[model samples]
Target: MVAHSAAKKDTGGGRESGSDAWKNYMRRQTITINYGRELPLAQGVEFKI
Candidate 1:
């Protein structure tokens, strides 16, 4: 999971970054699972605080 906080004047970059991170993470997880691995390279989550 990704966690991010942005100010009212922000341009939503944080959200985009969080989404990208999640997508990459899921892809890695899928590859790992397909290879019969029990843990992903990133076992936890990406936090943008």
Candidate 2:
């Protein structure tokens, strides 16, 4: 997902737009992963780790 987001930033759209798309995608993906803690959304990292 991160790779896809980075690729999109250069090829699909600008940084903010691609990042936002990745965020929305992450939200949806994480919803199903059932992480018990609230998302550490500050940098949109850690949740996946």
* lDDT top scorer: 2
Predicted structure 1: clash tally: 0
lDDT (10s digit) by residue, model 2, range 1-49: 6786577757857777777877898898888675544444445565454
Off by over 4 Å in 1: 1-13, 37-49
The pairs that clash in candidate 1 are none
Please give the lDDT score for candidate 2: 0.69
The number of the candidate with the highest TM-score is 1
lDDT of 1 by residue, 1-49 (tens): 3233343125556666667776898999898677555436546865355
For candidate 1, the per-residue lDDT at 47 reads: 34
Which ten contiguous residues of candidate 2 have the minimum total lDDT? 34-43
TM-scores for all candidates? 0.45, 0.43
Q: What overall lDDT, based on C-alpha atoms, would model 1 receive against the true structure? A: 0.61
